[model samples]
Structures are given as structure tokens and as C-alpha cells.
Target: MASSEQHYILPRPEFDKPTKVLIVISPYYKAIADDLLSGARAELDAAGASHETVEVPGALEIPAAISIAYRQSNFDGFVALGCVVRGETTHYETVCNDSSRAITLLGLEGASIGNGILTVENLLQAEVRANPDKQNKGAGAAAAALHLIALSRKWGRSGREIGFQPEGIQIAGKAEGPTTA
Candidate 1:
């Protein structure tokens, strides 16, 4: 039923300069991960964006990896890929919620992240979503990251200063030479 509904896809964003992206994947499900990676790679290629891939142990680690890369590397954006099939226990909920939350937190902290981690009812659902020929959620996620990167570039004030002013710099609206009172 949902598959029958059409969804609008935005055009891939254009960049004035070359963009670099990092794909952090949790290869817990090899086949699904491979398909997701393929889709992501294809989308990045179409946008003329450069990217590199890294593997983590599980879905929970995907966010951590992305956070580390965001701080230590110069990537313009990030794509997070993984499959979390619901299991008999509650572990599924934890993984899905925690990982999603962490990724959101990273985004709030100025990291351009596309969350492609699939939390599905079963393996079949994961497979369908990850398939490049089918849902291709990976491509959707990559598109999101690219859009975010574009927005950051558009609104970013690189020349402006943030945080505390350097030593000896006067605060704005304050007396420049001497106290009036």
C-alpha cells in the first residue's frame, strides 16, 4: 500500500566547490549493507561528490564513527548506512532509538548527516529498502546530506567570528576608551 504512493524527490544540489562525503556503514547484514552502499555510491557519483567508506561493528557504532570523522576530518557531509531488523527481544528498540538520537544530536552540532539506518520489521523489509532497484533508502539519505551541505554553504558565515572574542578585543556596544560613569 505505501509502496504504491508516489513521493517527490528533490534534485541533487549543486556545489561551487568539490564536496567530500564519508559513508559510515554497519555491515551487520552483509547483503543489505552492500546494496545500501551501492545506492549511496551511485547517488554521490551522480552529484560529482567524492566519498570514502568506513565499516563499523554494528548500528550503534555508526553514529560514533560519524562524530569522530566530523571532528577529525574535512568531509562536507556524511551518510550512515545499516540494517536493524526487529528481533524477539527489546534490543531492537534500543538500537534503533539510540542510534537515531545520536545521529540527530550530531546534526544539531553542525554535522551534515544523512541517516540511512533501516529499522524494519524483518529481513525482507530491510532487503527491499536497501535494494538500489527498489526503495533505495541509501540514495535518499545521501540526497538529504547533500542538501544539508548545500544549505550550510549558503548560510555559513566563515568570515564572522563566534564564541568569545580574542584577548584585547572590545565587546560590541561597550565603551571603547574610558568609562562614562
Candidate 2:
């Protein structure tokens, strides 16, 4: 049903400067992770963006890895790739929700992130979504990050200065006041 639905994909964004991305993956399902990584790599290559991949123990650690990278590295964007298949316990829900929320919080903090972590009911669904020839959620995630990166570059800075203007500084072409000392 999802496959039948029409989806609008945006044109790949162009970068004026060299773009670098960090991909953090949790390879719990090695096969699925491979397919997702392949798709993400292909998409990044097509957009002329370079990327580096790092592994973590599981899905919950993906966001933490990205957060660390965001603070320590100079990557322009991040792609989070992993598969969380529902299990017998409530742990599945926790992993799915918490990881997603953390990624969202990172994005809100001005980190350009594309979340490709798959939360599915079963392995079959994960396989379908992770397959490069099928859903290609990995590529989709990369694209999302790229778009956000473009937006960040576009409006990242404001020409106007922030905070209170210093005393004796000119305001609106007129001097605020006399300079002291």
C-alpha cells in the first residue's frame, strides 16, 4: 500500500562548498544495515557529498553518537541508519521512541540530521524498507539531511548583529552617546 502511494521527491540540493556528512549506523541487522548504507552512499555520491560511517551497539546509541560527532567534528550533516524490529517486550517501543526523540532534539539544536532509523513490525518490513532497490529509506534520509544543510547554509547567518548594542556605538547612523575614557 505504501509503495503504491505517490511520493514527491525533491531535487538533490547543490552545494557551493564541499559538503561532508557523518553516517552513524547500528548494525543489529547486518544485512539490512548494509543495504541501507549502500543506498545512503550512492545518494551522497550523486550529490557530490563525502561521508564517513561509524558503528554503534544499537539503535538507541545512534543519536548519542551523532550528538558526539556534532560537538566534536566538523561534519555538515548527519544520517542515522538502523533497524528496530518490534520484539515481545516493551523495549521495542522505548528504543523506537527515545531514539527518534533524541534525533529530533539534535536537529532542533541546529544539527542537520536525516533519520533513517527504521521502526518496523517485523524483519520483512525492515528488509523491504531498507532495500536500496525498494523503499530506499536510507537515501531518503540522506536527502532530507542535504536539504536541511542547504537551508542552514542559506539562512545560517543574519547580517544584523545580535544582543544589545554597546554604549557610545552608533545606532541607525547616529551616535548613541558620547564615548567615555
Whole-model lDDT values for every prediction: 0.93, 0.94
Model 2 per-residue lDDT tens digits across residues 91-166: 9999999999999999999999999999999999999999998999999999999999999999987455667777
Q: Could you tell me every candidate's TM-score relative to the true structure?
A: 0.89, 0.88
Q: After superposition, how far is residue 141 of candidate 1 from its true place, in Å?
A: 0.7
Give the Cα error of residue 74 in candidate 2, in Å: 0.3
- Candidate 2 error regions (>4 Å): 158-180
Counting clashing residue pairs in each candidate, in order, gives 0, 0
Model 2 scores what on Cα lDDT?
A: 0.94
- What is the per-residue lDDT of model 1 for residues 1-181, given as tens digits with 9 covering 90 to 100? 5556789999889988999999999999999999999999999999999999999999999999999999889999999999999999999999999999999999999999999999999898888889999999999999999999999999997656566655556655453344456
User: Which 10 successive residues of model 2 have the least lDDT summed?
Assistant: 157-166
Q: Given candidate 1, what's the lDDT at residue 106?
A: 98
